[model samples]
Target chain A: MKILLIEDELELATSVLDFLKSEHYLVELASDFPTAYEKAIVYEYDCLIVDINLPGGGTGLDVIRALKKLHPESAVIIISARNGVEDRIVGLDLGADDYLTKPFHLSELNARLKALLRRRHFGGSSDIVFHEIKIKPAERNVYIKENLLDLTPKEYDLLLYFLSNQHHVLRRESIAEHLLGDDADQMDDFNFIYSHIKNLRKKLIDRGCLDYVKAVYGIGYKFTDKK
Target chain B: MKLLHQTQRLFFRGVLPVFIAAGIVSFFTLRWVFDHETDEKLLGVQAEIESYVRINDTLPTFFQTVFDRWYAEPMPTGSMTNLKAYTFSDTMLFNKFENEIEPFRQLRFPVKMRGQIWMVSALTSTVEHHDLVLILAVLLVTMFGLLLLVMLWVNRIVSRQVWQPFFETLEKMRRFRLADHALLTLPPSSVEEIQELNTTLENLAYQVRQDYQTVKKFTENASHELQTPLAIIQGKVEILLQNDTLSETQAQQINIIGQSTRRMVRLNQSLLLLSKIENNQFLERKPVALKPLLEKRLVWLEDFIAEKKLELETILVEISLEINPFLAETLMTNLLTNAVKHNIQGGFLRVILNENYLIVENSAALPEASVKDLTARFARGNPHSEGVGLGLAMVVEICEQQGFGLEISFEQGIWRVQLRFRK
Candidate 1:
């Protein structure tokens, strides 16, 4: 899938670009408003990630407006530091699909992006299957070979998040943020994440499924079909 | 006191003494004029009798009957040396109607008739003591009545008209609120002092509102600007944590960095919320039921409470409050989180909701000093706890903005927070 990221902050843009690239998606960057406007008008993409406050004296809402007019089929998500409720309403009203506040976890962003794409391009399918593992997104139920695996709500969410970014290394902080959002900030320690991951892995391995969950040495965990 | 009543008080205070003094002085002056006129008439009568004696060379027969007394006696040799001597004295005379003695004013003088030295005495009609007192009393009463009428006019009509502008300005001030953004428009006045006061107050209110807006804007801009960079730092740390070649110790250190970055994000968000509340941004209000909201929050916090192995008891009465819905939610979340976060291991947490108030109590470690400090920003009872310390401060702010009463106290090793809703 092709994704266009319009952001003025080079460092944040680079981090986002690298993360998305590691997921094996084709990503392009537009560092200013005019460039973003030019590129958005010139080509069509599967998804558009736009920041509200763009450089060159224009807003991302204007970009979304222009893009919707030119390519009405494109999906748009607004990422902004201005987390005012009014801004969120305005963005959604302007035909954008989602709004994400800044200082958010990249993993959470990735999850939301996948959910949006799944709804837009995949006919709103709720079932996700990977070899022996099957997930019904609507019911939040997971199964291996037609046998149900009981999982806590948090564990199920964590597993789905891991499956979306199969090979990318998932940091503990990112996992915690995906699970708890801002509430994770109140936790004095990140040790609870380790237990949740361990339980999820055990539940899968006991269900006659290959263990795709891998520990990235001193960092965190990863799920991949690769050896 | 009300401004109008205060003015009346001062007016009466000043006018009452002057009225009494003037009445007394005028009463005495009238009495002196009456006595002086009576003396002049008696002297005229004596002079006329002496001239008649000189012109006709015989006493007038009508003089003795008309006057109280017309007596001519041989003057003593020493008294005759001075041709004329006049004297006035008060004397008593019998009244035939009432058959009682009455006071009189008598005049005595020396006269010469046909070169014969003679003494003449005359008494005017008796001037009753009671009549003199009654006249003075009437004069005093009349003066007092006039003064009362003037005072009443000034207090009720004149002063009210004069102070109308001042009272109007006072009323406007009483209704003014900084959050309403309504500028004070004082009524136009011709009085210089009232106009000056209104101008000064208007300028002061304008300056205060300007300063408040500037500060609010600064807080919003600063928070907005800091968010992106903080996001960048947090993202970089997350990326670094994914490196497989990093040592365990280095990974631990990076994990600490990530945790602190998350804390900073929470702190920044809390600060932004506080500023928004101070700016009165949450103006929408509705009646919210407390029982359901508290129950929902408790379910959300079940994990935290279980983690601490704390016993939880909730006694929620059916009560509804008028408040901003979002603020009410925030208040409940913060209070419940504080109760669970600060409680001791294996301790008890109690929540009680009633018609007038909501109380949250929890078993805690012995307080260092006082619970009053807990309501202030960054005042944490346990320094090692992970809370950002803005929770209770936000609760206090919401309470003040909503006109709810808040009190925090610690007793018997339990910390209790009570919020009283205005009826």
Candidate 2:
């Protein structure tokens, strides 16, 4: 996927760019508003991740508007430093697909971006396929070698999240947020992630599938097939 | 009493005594002067009769008007020495002309005639000062009543007109609120005191609004600034975690840092939400079926309940409330989650929801220390729990802002939280 990143903060931009590049996405960074505007108008990208607070005589909202007019097919996600709902409402009203407040997990952002793309681009054949496991997102079904694998809703979501960002360490916090949304706040819920991961691993192993879910040392989990 | 009515009542009370006292003094003064003149006229009538008898050598019986009568009685043989010269008395006389008894002031005087003194008595029946005094009293009272009525009428008109601007200012002040961002407005007035009051209030309102804006801006900018730095730290740490070159100690250190960073983020977001709720920024309302909402929320708590082996009993009726969905979710999520989080293993959790209130009662594990001030900030039920401790605080804030009643208490190791929708 080709994504245009509009950000003025060099440090945060570097981390995001490195993360996205490692995820094998063709990413371009526009550090200022004028350059972002020109690039957004000139080229067609599959997705545009625009920071709402940009420098150089313009805001990222204007760029999203102009890019959306030129290429209505391009997906847009707004990242704002403001936690206020007014700006989020305005951005959403102006045709942005999603809004992420600053200090967000890159993994969370990637999950949202993948979900938006899947809903937008793959509405007809919304299937996520791996080596042995295949998922029909529209039907909320998963199959292994023409045999249905009975999975709970949370387990299915966990497997899909791992598939979306394979080989990257997914923190327990990010997983909880993805699964629970606003209900993730105000308490520690590490036990739920642990129990769910254990059950999912057991179910898959019993079905003679390779263990793709790996737990990092004192960190979180990663999906990798390498020995 | 209304201000105008109270003033009128005080003035009415003050004016009555002076009016009564003035009428009494005037009546007495008129009566005293009238009596002196009547006495002089009676003596003069007696002198004329004596002069006529002496000059003509007989009693003068020429003529008499209808209201006047006179008589000459011969003095007794030697009784003239006992009666000095003159005597006067008021008598009731029966007049054949008028049938009713008439009051007469009479005087008796001695007239020497042929060595025997002729005693003469003159009576005047036209003494009408009693009726005159009564007429004067009635006139005085009538004038006082007219004066009081005119004063009351004038006072009513004056107060209604003059206090108009003050009432208008009061109404405008009552309607002024910071949430609407409307400036205070006042109607102009010609009265100096009222005009000054309006200006002062307008100035005060302007100052209050300016201060409010400043506080609001500061909160937004502060949150923004803090969030950016925290984002940078969080992003850098997230990127650093992707590497596979860290020692065990380093990994542990990073894990600690990450945990603290996430906790900070939650704290920041919670504080911001609290401020927004207090500012009355969330005013959108929609009718919601609370039974389904709570049922769904309870499903999210299934994992936690199963983990602690809690027994949750929920009795939700079909109750509809007009509220912002975000607030309802927050309040319920906090209450439901806290109940489960703090409960004992195999303990009972009972949630009863009716039209009036929502009650959540749960048994606790090792809750010997009384959890006082549960809704205060950072006052956790468990001192070592991983919560940021603003959960119940946020619930309390939303309840207060939305005019809901909240009662939280811990008794005999059972914690109960009651949220009342109706007062």
Candidate 3:
């Protein structure tokens, strides 16, 4: 998949680029409005991550409008520091697929991009299979080798999120944000995340599946099919 | 007092004494003039009678016909010495037409007729004391009525026209809100005092609005600048945590950094939200069914409540509130979060909703904290607690902007928050 990231902040853009590259997606960068607008019109991208506040005079909304006219099939996600509901509504109404507030985790952004891509490219498929584990997105049900696995709603969501971004290192903060959204900011510790991960790991092991979930040292969990 | 009414009262206070004094002075002055004229007429009649007696050497028969009453008595011979005194006195006489005794002003004079000293007394006309009083009373009443009517007419015109601009400025000031960005406009006035007042008020309002915008801009820029760096720090920490050579202690220390970064981000977001709310950015409003919304939020919060092991009870009535839906949801979420966060393990939570209010009560683990401190920014019952402390503060801001009443109290080891909505 090819994606374009339009952001003025260099550190945030680098982190997002690194995370998406590790997921094996080809990504392009545009730091200002004019370049972003030019690139968006010239080349076709499967997805576009546009920041509303560009370094130049123009805004990302303008770019989204132009890009939508140029490539109607491209999916756009708006990343803005402005958390106002009106801005979100305006972005979504202007044909943007999703809106994420600033200071967000890279993993959460990846998860959103994955969901958007799945819907856009896969024609809204419900079933996703990775080796022995299978998931029904519509029913939120998971099974292993024809045996249904019992998982809480949150656990089911976490499993699906990890499966979508397999082999990518997921930070605890990103996992927390993906699960709790804005509420994760209030948590002072990651003990609950640890517990949830423990239970999910034990459940998968009990179902005779390989240990696909791995801890990347001090960082967080990663789901992979690689040996 | 209202400005118009106050002015009217002052005018009455000043005019009332002058009106009474004028009435008294005019009454007495008129009475004295009328009395002097009557005396002059009586003297003229005396002169004509005396002239006739001197010409004919006898009293005229016209004296008895012209006067209402008359008497002439001669003093004894050799006892009267220069007996030619003239005097006037009031007397009572019987009136045959009205069959009553009426007052009269009488004049007496001594006239010489054929070398005899004759005492002559004549009644000129009836002059009742009450007649003078009645005339004075009628004249004073008519003057008073005219004065009152003129004063009322002037007051109405002055209040409606002369003070119209003042009143308009007053109304504008009443409706002025700093967030609305609509400056007060006062019509130009011919009056110097009102003009000065309007100019000063306009300057004051302009200064205030400028200051408010400055503060709002500063907050927005500060939040935006701070957020990017916070994100960078958090990102670096996450990257560092991925190193396999790191010790457990290193990981724990890095986790602390991550946790504090999260807290800072939340604080920044809350402050930004407060500034936005103060700036009146959330203006769109719709009628929201609050009960269903609350129920939905509760379902989302079920995990949080379950983790706390708090027993939940809800009495949600169908209440419709007119407010911005985003703010309404945030308010409810904050209230529920506070209730669960502050409650003790295995505690009880009751959410009661009625037509006018929503009440959330929870059993507290520690001693009851001050309601003022609890609702303030960064306030927490337990210092070690993970709460960012902006929940209640945001709730309070939302309540104030939305014209809702928020009351917090702690009693019997229970923390209760009540939100009263306008009917």
User: Which residues of candidate 3, in runs, are more than 4 Å off?
Assistant: A1-8, A12-100, A106-149, A157-175, A182-227, B48-68, B72-85, B90-133, B181-207, B242-254, B274-292, B315-328, B342-423
Q: For residues B1-423, could you state the per-residue lDDT of candidate 1 as single tens digits?
A: 976678777877787888878777777676677778778888888888878888897767764433266666767666577564789998887767668777777888777766667777778764643477567768687878787878777678877898889889999999888755778789889999999999999999999988888987897778777899899988788677666687889877886787787788878888888888888889899999999999988876666677678999999999888889988988998998888877888999999999999999999988564677878898777787666888999999999899999988888988899999972
Per-residue alpha-carbon lDDT of model 3 for B1-423, expressed as tens digits? Answer: 987778888888888888888788877777777777777888887898889889987877763543266677886787567654678988777777777777777898988889997777778664543477668768786979798879877897878898888888898889888877788777788999999999999999999999989999899879878988887877677666655577878876887797788788888988888788878888899998999888977876666677778899999899788899888988888888778767787999999999989999999876435789878888888887876788888899899889988888888888898989972
Model 2 lDDT tens row, B1-423: 988889889988898888889889988888877766776888888778778777877888747765678888898888877886788788888877878788887888888887788888887773477788889889988998899899899988998888878888888888887655678889989999999999999899999889987887677667657887788888877777777787767766776787788888888787777767767778898887888878887898888888888887988899989888888888888888888888888898899999999999999765534555667887776777888888888898888767798888887778888989965
Q: What is the lDDT of residue B177 in candidate 2?
A: 74
Put down candidate 3 lDDT per residue, A1-227, tens digits, no spaces.
99999999898888888778877899999999999999999999999999998977799999999999989899999998887777899999999999988777777788889888888988767578999999877567899997999999789889988998777667777887788766555444455677788889999999999999998666678898775
**Per-prediction fnat:** 0.53, 0.75, 0.33
Candidates 1 and 3, the one with greater DockQ: 1
Best-first order by TM-score: 1, 3, 2
- Each candidate structure's TM-score, on Cα atoms with residue i matched to residue i, is 0.78, 0.68, 0.72
Question: Stretches of candidate 2 above 4 Å error?
Answer: A84-86, A118-127, B1-217, B365-372
Error of 2 at B280 (Å): 1.1
lDDT of 1 at B417: 92
**Which candidate wins on TM-score?**
1
